[model samples]
Target: MSDFNSKHEKVAAKLRNEITGTEYEPGDQLPSEKRLCDYFKVSRVTVRHALQTLENERLIYRKQGLGAFVADTTLNSGLVQLTDFSEDMKKAGLKSSSGLISLDKVEPIKEVNEILQLRPDMKLIRIDRIRFANGNPVAFDITWLPPGYGQLLFDEDLTTQTIYDVLEDKYEIPIQGGSYRITAKNADDYIAKHLGIAPESAVLEIDRCSRTTGNKKVYFQKRYYNPSHVSYVLELSRNDNESMSSKDGLPLKEFSPSFAK
Candidate 1:
């Protein structure tokens, strides 16, 4: 029932199934390009693309001079702390900078109301900027602020400084807990141009809503990151004395067993 337009996707899906079903186990060599072409009755380009799709998913890996092989399945990062963007870059030894794209006071939109608990007529200061690491555009951030905070953006140079720093130093906004959701998306024309990637290229989009001790939502931000450049990592440990593996064979190492002695 699949259509012609989804030919590549269909092939990719089938290839993924084969990988999951152990048609090719970890460390097992994949068939050569010509062999894959013959088996799938597809062109070399199609086969290569299928493999590339798997590579991106970390389901398979290519070894130099050796054929592609199934990757050792492992759990990715877990959700934990809400780290500051500028601090993360600094720790990575990357020269981080921000360029102000726009700053305006606008009436809170419907989505803003839900995220920030804004009143019906409340206004907000919205800032859009490009965050650079090592002078290369890595993220496009649009940050929203509740009213009065608009003053902070005007007196401080948000372009060359960390927003978190400005918030703490000038506005006295306490660094409190926040929540974030991350997912993969394709870049649109605007994002593509800004990030220097082709339209529809893969991107990791993070939606974050931060609040203070009083639960006052001060910042709601949308960050679009280039997956090829940066990866988000979270460290966790296991606490339960259960067996190491689950019914699905996933490890039970969810929390660290020991604290600092």
Candidate 2:
């Protein structure tokens, strides 16, 4: 590589480490470009290149005429992977936790009942929680599970453990796959309260149905994510014959047809 390229990359590497580490937290503004140039003994162009690299990685975002600020470093998930909240936070180098809102056995809504293939009289275990990343509220989740799987959670601590972990590890019920429907919605009063955002703020909503062996549904959950703290990346290939699939075990056939939208 040329000396110029090497210098810019070195600058970017240093900044990347600092942003990912405790040195710089989310929303922290980076040093001015002029200051960075002076400190690194590089030209303005080199510093700009470094900043551009970090921006492309989603580690930082630059404001026109203002400066670059660290991006929220939580819950950035690649759509191809099937990971829980804890796993996503870990991958982003953020601490993950949950605050249990309510856990109860109740009659589920009609939609949920149908999704779980339960009779009208059957009650489901409902778990409501606010998920946190580095102690910041990131998502409000409402999960409904069938009686058998739901009973397992009563003994486990929801604050420190995810339902996915509990079912897969303790009960040995592997979550084989899931179907997801993603959308954007304005936060209602209840969702806003739990997510600690303004009422009517935009949020990313995900309706997910996870299944175990033999395609038996395990849980149906609605997750409302704080947009500022979460982002999703979808990777696609150009080959027409290539089958598109989600690493998160989501079946593409479950996705809504283009004309249906």
Candidate 3:
């Protein structure tokens, strides 16, 4: 058993090297399991184990009928980092643009008001936008901010500039950190229209609350990503002091889908 494990690990290491070293580019199909077994002089089971390892690492994805292909890392973002949409697109070698849907001061729903911690009489500035990457719609975003910070955005060109950029550079309001809640949602008519996907298609939704200096909440945003255009990556270290039971672990709850009217 030990010898078999070692053999599979060796095979996986070699394939990982090739994939990372540019021998196999993104979206390139890998050799079949039989071919890999013949090349590595290993059993089919060993080859399968190696392929599974790569798939777990998100380095490759396998089709039901077709063989495994390298994953496009450009579409992946690290979950641990807090980056602006435009910044992320730029890093992926794509031009970022936004189509403003609406920007107005509105009465907040109970949930939005509670999340933003607004006063009773305070109206929220809401900004709705469709984010694009290389001219392709990738995400639909709705942002809610207190009147103070949000009104300032009214004067800026949201199509080309990110709220993060404006807040940090123009207003000198450094974004300290944020909390995120991620879930899988099915696109409704409104989301489908903005993202150019069929209604009922699966999408990745993230709810984020950002803060500024002195731990003051800045803004709350809901971003829905087209699964075909975006993927999230999270790296974990076993040596970290934060244990899964204490830091990373949260009580599991049933998911309920909500659709737009």
Q: Model 2: per-residue lDDT, tens digit, 22-93?
A: 998888999999999999999877787677667656688889899999987563422243557887787777
Report the Cα RMSD per candidate. 21.1, 17.8, 17.7
lDDT for 237 in candidate 2 is 31
Ranking by lDDT: 2, 3, 1
At residue 144, candidate 2 shows an lDDT of: 98
* Better structure of 1 and 2 per lDDT: 2
Question: Candidates' lDDT values, in order?
Answer: 0.71, 0.80, 0.80
Model 3, 1-261: lDDT tens digits are 245557877999999999999798899999999999999999876677678667756688999889999987654312334567876776677888999999999996778878878776678999999998888898999999998899899988999888987876566565656888999999999999999999999999999999875677889999999878887754433423333345444322222222211
Q: How many backbone clashes does candidate 3 have?
A: 0
- Model 3: weakest 10-residue lDDT segment is 252-261
Give the winner by TM-score: 1 or 2: 2
Q: Please identify model 1 stretches exceeding 4 Å from their true place.
A: 1-79, 241-261
| lDDT comparing candidate 3 with the true structure | 0.80
Model 2: CA > 4 A from native:
1-79, 240-261
Candidate 1 C-alpha lDDT tens digits along 38-91: 887876655665676577566778987888998766544122334576767766
